[model samples]
Target: MSVLDFDNLTKRYGRTTALRELTLSIPEGSVYGLLGPNGSGKTTTLGLALGVLQPSGGTVRWFGAPATAATRRRVGALLETPNFYPYLSARQNLQIAADVKQTDARSLEAALETVGLAQRQREPVSGFSLGMKQRLAIGAALLGRPEVLVLDEPTNGLDPQGIADVRALVQRLAAEGRTVIMASHLLDEIEKVCTHVAVLHQGQLRSAGPVAASLATADRVVLGLAPGTAADVLRAALSSLPFVQDVRPETDGRVSCALAIGHSPASLNQALFAQGLALAHLEMRHRRLEDQFLELIKN
Candidate 1:
């Protein structure tokens, strides 16, 4: 079942349309990556999902119901840059979060420990570094023991170890059956962590589905070959085959080409063999989510 759904959502600002008829379903217990470049309305979508910003049109649902005060308790969010009272200690800041979320006040200690901030619990927020501050902000979100987590750039501005720590925590949250919605420009991270993905561009959803499913295709295949006299002969033979789009030499003595629909790897191999060239390697490269995002923005 979907934990969150946006049904024909639209948001307008004066003459600008921030979002347009956006629709998506986030499955329960999935790590969903909400991805797009800057000014692509990713942040706006997150705001609307959490009920921090009301939509001008359509509605957002949490567990098949509209976002409400009761729903807020089940959801935890880290939107934009986290802000805390500089004078307050990390422990004190989380205390405020605990008071608001109505969770156990002592859960603050558990939250601090989870984010590796146990020893710095008494340190003032102003004294914390950027990555430390980010961790503390996440600690605040985890204080409520939420069923869903909405985070924007959770690993941004962090060192390598800090990034790894945050990544591990997010993965652990999903393992514990929490639905996590993460927005980031880090495509590699999304590729690694997200089970499902939603690509947004110009405030609209370009694509939304399982990461693996979306990447599955038979559009084209790139083949690497041994550097030899058969390169031209191989190209000539494959070029005559039906559904071959284009063939070009690669920097690594390989031939890159595209295959049309109904063209199988076996057929491609057969064509190459007919020309006296043996296949060194055969790999199909599908359109990446990053490539799809760029295509949407360009259009």
Candidate 2:
């Protein structure tokens, strides 16, 4: 089931339209990534869905119903920098958050343990690293035991270790059956952790689907024939195979071609062997997510 849905959602500020007619659904139990560069309306879309900003037109729904207090209670979000009392201990800070959230203190221990801050719960926030602090912020958001979590650039300003920590934490949360919607400009991070992604550009939806399906490209298979085999023979054989596409000559005297869906390098090898050709070299070149991301936004 969809945990959230945006129907023709639009947002504007005077003459500037921050987001335009964006219709998308976030599935339950998915680690959904909102992918875009800065000012691509990623934050604006989150704001509209959270009701922090009113939509200029369209609708935001939660669990197949309009967002209300009860529905909002099911979602926890961290949209800005994590703010904490510098002198307060980690546990104390969470207590304060619990008070604000009006959630019972019974969930405090679980939140601390979930964020891996249980051991340092008594340490001052001032002494914790930026990564620890971000985890605490997420712990605070978890105070109400919300079913959905929305994080905007959860690892925006962390060290490598910090980024890894947050990424793992997000994965754990999703594993526990909570829906997570995170916005990020880092293609690698999204590609690594997100099960699904929605790419946005200039306030418009570019693409949205499961990561494998959305970013899938025909991987090119490079082939080299025996010393006695002419390149034309190889090209001719490839051309005859209807599944082979975009046959091209590599600079290193190798031929490369893409195969249709459901076709594999093994299948290609067998097909060539059936036609009295043998390969001396065979390799599959996979496409990078960065290349795909750039292609999506370049236009």
Candidate 3:
């Protein structure tokens, strides 16, 4: 069943339109990604869906009805940078969250443990680092044991380990049958955690569907470089190749570049070899979520 539905939802600010006829459904128990560049209406969409902003032209339906208290109880969101009382300890902050969520206060410790903040629960939020604060924010969102979790740029200011932590937590949530919707500009992060993705551009949805299907729809091309050249040097040279769309350098002197004009792997290698580039690493490279995202935005 669809846990969240946005049907022709539109929002505006003065003369500026923030969302344009957005229509999508997030199925229950799936990790959905809301992907777009800055100012692409992702936050606005989340705001409207959470009943924080009223739509100007359409409706956001939760559980097949208008967003209401009952529906809100099942949905928890960490929109933008989550704010908390800096003076309060993590446990105290979560106590406040429990009150707001109308859930049992005893669940606070469990929520803290879920986000890996159990050990730091007594530490004041002010002394916590940015990553710790993010974890606490997630704990607050989990206060009610919500069936649906909505997080916007949850990894915005974290180090590698923090990012990994959040990613693991999200995966664990999805594994446990919770519906997760993440709004983020980090395409790689979305690729790693999201099973489905919605791409938005200029206040309009460009695509909405499974991540694998969207990635497969993208054109693929491979370029093989001669041996002896450093990967960086080969990447720079191949990037200058005609129709070469992107270049990702791997370990060793191996580089893969996608061609804008979709061609078979063999054809790509033939073209490169014709240009005096030797064939060492020749295989079709899979398109990353960022590649598909940029393609959507550009078109």
Candidate 4:
């Protein structure tokens, strides 16, 4: 059974529909990234999935059944900015949270260790940096040993080093065999950390798949031919290689083709030379995640 499933989930705040019949399934062991622009319903989906907000229509299931009071304990979430007592120490704050959640001492210890906060557990919250505070919040979410961790914009408002620290911590948590559901506008973070991605635009799903395949939508092997090289000759040469696809002539006398996954641009160039047309230039343009993200939001 999938870790989480949203079945035609829809949400409306009176006249404003936040989500529109969205359906998705998150498998076990996936670091799932929920991606979209500011108002594309990423947060709304998380909220509905966590039962923080009631959906206007549809159902959310956890581990093959509808979410219930018991099901929520299996998932942990850190949405928006976290709050802790300024005067309280990190350990104290977590102890309070643990008391509220009924988490035991062993679980709390494991949680602090997972986020690398055990060394500073006794330090006051006022002494912690933004990244440290974020880690503490994640540590709190780890209470009760939840199987799935849900984080919304977890890296927001941190310095570069802090971002790196949190990123590493997140990677470690996922390595320990926990499914992670994260919502973020940062494509780089998603690309670096997530195994699966679901993109939303205008409250609708634009695409969903493995991160590599999603970003590899149209990776091109750019071939700039020598002057006066006929486009037909290039097309004819490419025809012999079935893996070369979407062959088109550029206005500047360059020809570009989609290289099949696992095939490098060097291999494509070698294939072209073997076909007896060795002329000018060959370059590989690996499509950027941001470029793919923009295209999704644009359409």
> How does each model score on TM-score?
0.85, 0.88, 0.79, 0.88
Q: Write model 3 residue lDDT over 1-299, tens digit each, in one string.
A: 99999989999899999899999999999899999999999999999988788889888889889998778888888988878999999999899878878899988878898878888889899998877888788889988789999999999778888889889989999999999999998888888999999999989999999997777657454444566665665566566667666676565556665555455667666666766667666766576777778878995
In the predicted model 4, the residue pairs found to clash are none
Ranked by TM-score, the better of candidates 2 and 3 is: 2
Model 3 misplaced stretches (Cα beyond 4 Å) = 219-282
Task: Evaluate residue 42 in candidate 3 and report its C-alpha lDDT on the 0 to 100 scale.
Answer: 96
**Pairs in steric clash, model 3:** none
Question: What C-alpha RMSD separates each model from the true structure?
Answer: 3.3, 2.5, 6.8, 2.7
lDDT of 1 by residue, 1-299 (tens): 99999999999899998888989999999999988888778889999988788899988999999889888888888988887999999999999888889999978889999989999889899999988889888998898789999999999778999888888989999999999999987788888889998888888888888887765542457776665655666577668877777787766666777776567778889877876778887887776766765765687
Q: lDDT of all the models against the reference?
A: 0.84, 0.89, 0.84, 0.86
Winner by TM-score between candidate 3 and candidate 1: 1
User: Which model scores highest in lDDT?
Assistant: 2
What's the alpha carbon RMSD for model 3? 6.8
Residue 124 of model 4, lDDT score: 95
Q: Model 2, 1-299: lDDT tens per residue?
A: 99999999999999999999999999999999999999999999998888889999999999999997778778888875778999999999999988866789989999999878899999999998777888888888888888999998999667787788788988988999999999999899898999999999999999899888755553688999977667999999999999999999986578999888888999999999999998999999876777777888987
The superposed Cα distance between candidate 1 and the true structure at residue 108, in angstroms, equals: 1.3
Q: Write the per-residue lDDT of candidate 4 for residues 32-146, one digit (tens) a residue.
A: 9999989999999999998889999999999998898778877878887677997999999999888867778678788888778899999899988877888888889989978
Which pairs clash in model 2? Answer: none
